[model samples]
Target: GRKRTFLACVTWFSVLMVLCAAAPGPEFFAVVRFLAGIGLGGVMPLAAAFTTEFAPRDRAAVAYVIMQSGYPVGGVAASLLAKWIIPEFSWHWMYLIAALPLITVLPAAWRWLPESAEEQSVAASREERRDAARAGLRAIFAPGIRTTTVMFWVMSFCSLLFVYGANTWLPTLMQDDGRGFSSSLNFLLCFNLGAIVGGIAAGWAADRWGSKIVVTASFLVGALAVLAFSGADGTALLLVLAAVAGYGAVATQTLINGWVTRSYPAQARTTGVGWSLGIGRIGGIVGPSVTGWIVSATSGGTAAFLLFAAVGVVGALVAGVVRHAAR
Candidate 1:
């Protein structure tokens, strides 16, 4: 059933994200993105859970960041396609061509994916597993950690809200400030370019400075960048601000994920990270929806940007206040 679940979700995930290949127009593309977001909502967090679960304990943070770094890498690829592929062929081709890799990944997953060794061992040792499972549940709620977990959850919620909101609306936000469609597209490219750099920088900084410090600063900087973008109507200025926003929002999120991975031992790491993501997805769901509403209601994207910028502030404060609860 685990394999079946993985197969089903992965298949849908791959199919959905790439289906933009066939999109007819703006409305259809938006619908495709919606459906793809649904599949992605399932696959991405689970993939992170698996990576952290199997990684060596000492290097779980590195493993988590490295695994998740694919997110921004993919963003960079999409931005490149928007530049080169879309012009050469179409956005449809861009999506379809990128899906080519799944030809290998799907079959490899089917043939080789297995429960991690620890999970397999837990399956074999029933009594020990029962005991460990109970303690794992308790560990999350035992005083200090309970506070940290709650703070982490709140921070995750706010961070994702900011990430998804800007990611979905940044183009429109730029255009609303009088930039042409071309400049808006260029902003997306610069934003994702910033994301790729942010991913690398976050990993390096987290390792040297600690996930908490990196995450806190990421949120803080992201907040300022986003707030500043409201006034950055100049094309070059806006592009630079977009990159800062990407660094702050996207990089901060990966570091928070790394934090979740590091906070718990192997026994509960999957549950910890998975649940944190699951619950935080409340914000993920709300983000784009609310942004759409605000943009429509106000007839501009300025309000949406400011609202989400304030969300970045909340995330920064939460990350700053939480005491580390690693066990």
Candidate 2:
């Protein structure tokens, strides 16, 4: 069933991406992009749940983190692709490039991806499926788990806020810090490169130690990076800070996702991960907008970085407070 849902979401996202490429006007493009967001949103938690289900119990967190690394990897790829494609072809071609997953990943996934045992059981009985769904929802809120769920939600919100806000504003912030135009862009690249490396590192560390301490430390590391960014003087130092910030923000999100996968059982995994992400998506929506306002109001100074760094602290505290999984 999750395989079916994953395939449907891929199809939905791919089709909408195609529509976005062919959009006639700004309004049409906006509407189609919003619809595509729905597809993109569904793909994430489902993928996380799927990864956790198939991975060995002890290795699930690492596997999920490795999978999550693809997000930043994709970001790096897009940045490179855009650099090449936009000059030669156009922006529309970029969307067309995104739509290629329809022909590539979709068909490959359909051919190779297997449904989990849990999914197969539900598929055989509709009443059992309904009961499982209800049970999963119930389990997330049951007693000891409810507090963990809420704290996870808060951590997700703060992590996403750090992620989106930094990714959207890092370039501008770098420029404000006196870097040249090209160097500003380079910082963004370093940032994502950091995320790619940091995510994998955090993953292995999480598998070795556990998600709780690793996630907490990673968030604090990111906050320090963000705070140090305000006073960064040399280009080399600024770039290093950017990379660290990326590690702190992006990799922490990866760890959080992994923790969710390791925390919930197969029956409730998707529901738990999906709702946490659903709430985090709201923070994602707010992040860029709030940063834009801060930039406009404060001119992307120390105050902006301070505020974001504070959010990172909040995320660390929230992660620290998440109790052991109830079930």
Candidate 3:
């Protein structure tokens, strides 16, 4: 079921991406992109649930972080690709390139990606399967599960706020510090690269110790790194802080995803993950807009980063409050 859902999402988004490239006007493009977003949104939770279902139980975090590492890897690659593509051709070409996954990844996925283990275990009538799904959705809010669900929402919100806020503002913040365009862009690369490497390391740490301690510490590290951005001695130091902040923001979210996936009953896992992400996206939606207002109302990048750092602190606290699940 997850495989089928995943493939359909991929196909839906891919076709819309091509339409985006050919849009006759901004209004048309915006509507098509919104439709495409529906497809893109479904893919992530299913992918997480699918991967979690198949992972060795003890190594769920490791499997998840490995899968999630693809996001930053793709981010790093896209930054490089966009630098060339936008300058050489136009922004439209970038959309065309995104659509290439239809031809490339979709076929491979259709042939190979397996249904989630939970889905396979329940070979039943359609009504029975639907009933199971509905029960799973309701289970997330039942008794002991309800508190953790709310805490996960808080953690998810703060984590995404850190992620989108920094991503939307990092380069512009760097430029505000009197750096050139080329130098500013380098921060984005370092940011994503940090997430890729740091995320894997954090995953290993999560497996060894636990997700709770590592996630809280990562948020604190991000907060400290972001606060230090204003006082860094030079570009080199700033770059290092950017990397740490990336680890704090992006890598923390990846860990949260892993934790969310592993925390739920197999039947309710996708519903749990989906709801967490759905709620968290509101923070993502707010981050860029709020940071934009902060930057505009304030004098420099310092204020914006400071606000982001404060949000990271809140994230750390929220993460700390999460009760660990019993084995």
Scored by TM-score, the top model is: 3
RMSD to native, candidate 1:
3.7
Please give the CA lDDT of all the candidate structures.
0.75, 0.85, 0.86
TM-score of each: 0.82, 0.95, 0.96
Native-to-model Cα distance after best TM-score fit, residue 128 in candidate 1, in Å? 8.5
Which structure is stronger by lDDT: 2 or 3?
A: 3
Tens-digit lDDT track of model 1 for 214-297? 888888888888888876656788789888898887778888887886787666665567667777888887999999999899
After superposition, the stretches of candidate 1 with alpha carbons farther than 4 Å from their true spots are 1-8, 16-39, 53-59, 83-101, 110-115, 125-143
Ranking of all predicted structures according to TM-score, beginning with the best and ending with the worst: 3, 2, 1
Whichever of 1 and 3 has more lDDT, that candidate is 3
Tens digit of per-residue lDDT, candidate 2, span 1-327: 788889999999999998999999999999999999999999998998889878876776678878888888877887677667877888899898889889988999999988878767654688878888898899889887888988889998998988898888877777776775566778878888899898888888888888899999999999999899888788888889988999998989988987886687678889999999999988898998988888899866677788789999999998888778423
lDDT of 3: 0.86
Q: Name the regions of candidate 2 deviating beyond 4 angstroms.
A: 176-181
Candidate 3's C-alpha runs over 4 A off are 324-327
Candidate 2 shows a clash count of 0
